[model samples]
Structure formats: C-alpha cells, structure tokens
Target chain A: MSIVGEIIISALLLVGAGFMLVGSLGLARLADPLQRLHGPTKATTVGIGAILMASMLYQFVGHDKISFHEFLIALFLFITAPISAHLLAKAYLHMNRTDRE
Target chain B: MISIALAVSAAAISFSVVLNLWRLLVGPTPTDRLLALDTMVINSIALIILFGMSYATFIYFEAALLFAMVAFVATISFCKYLLRGNVIE
Candidate 1:
C-alpha cells in the first residue's frame, strides 16, 4: 500500500480506538442503568462501525483480500445488540412492575 | 491512504465513545447500565476488527466473533433471570 494509504488506515484505527475507550468509560461511570443505555447504544455503535470499516479498508488495500469476517461480526452485533437491550429493558420493567404490585 | 482512513475512523469512534460515557454517567436506572454494556461489547468487536487489520492477522476476527456470541448469550440469560427470577423459569 502507498504511504498515504497506510497513514489513513492508522488514523482510522486510532480514532476507532479512542471511541471504544470513551464508550467503555461511559459504561463504567454512568450514574443509572436506564440512562447508561444511551451511551453504548448510539455512540458505541458508531464507534465500532468506524473501526470495522477501517479494518476492512486496510485489508482490502494491503492484502488484496476482501475479509468478510469483520462484516460477519458486525452483522451479528447489529442484529443482537438491540434484542439484548430490549430484553434487558423489558426484564427491568417487569421487575419494577412486580415490585409495585 | 489506508492508514489515514483507519486513523480518521478511529478518532471518530473515540469521540462517539466519549459521548456514550457522558450518557452512562447520568443514566437513571439499572437497565441503562446493561444497555451501555451491550454497546460496549459491540464497540469491542469493532476494535478487534481494527486490531486484525493493523496486525494483518485473522486470529483477532475469531476472538471478536466469539466474544459477540458470548455477550449475546450472557445478555439473554441475564435478562431472562431478571424478568422471571430464574433462567429455567
């Protein structure tokens, strides 16, 4: 790959890593569970997508191989995250309901 | 070109993470925490993919995939437990 390409890839990686770090920090420091969900669902999803795109670009440019594994992971994550969040939130609501009864 | 792209993407992702952190800090309930955790796992998967590209290796992809599977299962179980008071129930 050309030097410019390499530089771009590195930049993407760094940015992606920064996002991941921020997301984790948010996860750890959030004050309440309901509010905490906002951080990971939105920011983290975008952050992860950026990183994955960078990786795919790097592999495509350098190795000449269209690595689809990353895509598979991304797909799995995209499909499952919302479901998990929904389930958890539902559970929480159910518990609250029971407690109030 | 590739490096520059990667770097830029990484930086953007980092900014998002920071924003998420702000939400986590102010969340008002336990469900919010779990939601943050779910987002964290997704971000981790992306980070793993970036690592795979940086190192020019495929092993990281496998690990990332595995982590996703485990995270999904764990989340489901936890949610079930919370709702019914037992995974079996």
Candidate 2:
C-alpha cells in the first residue's frame, strides 16, 4: 500500500477502536439502563462502520481490487441498529411502566 | 504502519469486548444485558474485519456479513420477546 493509504487506514482503525472503547465504557459505567442505551446503538455502530470502511479501503488500496462486501455489512447494521434499539427501549419502558403509575 | 495500527486497534477493541462482558455479567437489568450483548456483537464484527485486513484476505468478508445478519435477527427477536412476553405470539 502507498504511504497515504497506510496513513488513512491507520487513522480510521484508531478512530474506530477509540469509539468502540468509549461506547463500551459508557455501557459499563452508565447508571441508568436508558442512559446506557445510547452507547451501543450510536457510538458502537459508528465504530464498526468506520472499521468496515477501513476494510473496504484496505482491499482497494492494499490489494488493488474493488470490494463492496463490507458495505453490505455496514448497511445491514445501520438499518437494523436503530430498529433494534427502539424495540429494546420500548421493551424497557413497558417493563417499567408500573413505576410511573 | 497499517500493521501497527491493526495491532493497536485490535488490542483496544478486545479490551472493549471485555468491558462489554463485564457489563453483561453484572448488569442489574435485562435491558442492560441485552445492550451489552449487542455491543459485543458489534465489537466482534470489527475484530473480524481487522483480522481480514491483517491477513489480506477476502473470504472473511462473507463471515462478517453473515454474522451481522444473524446478530441483528437475534437481537430483534430477543427484543420482541422482551416486549411481548413471547417471540412468535
């Protein structure tokens, strides 16, 4: 891979890893279940998305081949994450509904 | 440079997975556990991608894609069960 490609891949990997770390930290340390919901849904999804982007670039720049398979993973995750998060949140709220009564 | 980055990022992501495990084991609520499991799935996906990049292979791409699909369905079904007291009903 060229120097520029290497640098870009490195930056993306580091950034993605950092985001994953922070998301996990939030998941572990947040006080409320609802509060903790933010971490994995947003930050972690973005983190993996970034990593997949890096993978796509790696295939292109390093191997000199076009690869779009990573995009399918990213797209599936992006579409499903919010739906699952929403369902989880709804379930949590319903489970706790008696408290508000 | 790419190898160094891959190593560091892999280490960091692995640590994050450990954190997710801790939350999964110790979470006070089922929702918290679910959240942790979901995060762990995402982290694992990232790890697989990193491994593929490290090895310079294309085969792992399908593995990652299939894992993502399976994980998503699993999460959704779990959520549905939680919401409705049953997955199918």
Instruction: Compare the candidates by DockQ and give the number of the best one.
Output: 2
Question: In candidate 2, which residue pairs get closer than 3 Å at backbone N, Cα or C atoms, i.e. clash?
Answer: none
lDDT tens per residue, model 2, B1-89: 99999999999999999999999999787888888888898899899999988887779878888888888888889888888889986
B7-59 per-residue lDDT for model 1 (tens digits): 55545555555555555565555566456556656765665665565566877
Q: Write the per-residue lDDT of candidate 2 for residues A2-82, one digit (tens) a residue.
A: 899889989999999999999999999888999899988888888888898998898888788888898888898999989
TM-score for each candidate, following the candidate numbering = 0.73, 0.96
- Residue-level lDDT for A20 in candidate 2: 92
Worst 10 residues of 1 chain A by lDDT: A34-43
| TM-score (0 to 1) for chain B of model 2 | 0.97
Please give, as one word, the docking class of candidate 1.
acceptable
Candidate 2 residues lying further than 4 Å off, grouped into runs, are A98-101
RMSD value for candidate 2:
1.2
Q: Estimate the overall C-alpha local distance difference test score of candidate 1.
A: 0.67
State the lDDT of candidate 1 residue by residue for A9-88, as single tens digits. 66666665665666566666666555555556655665666667667777788889898887887787778767876787
Positional deviation of B34 in candidate 1, in angstroms? 4.2
Candidate with maximal TM-score: 2
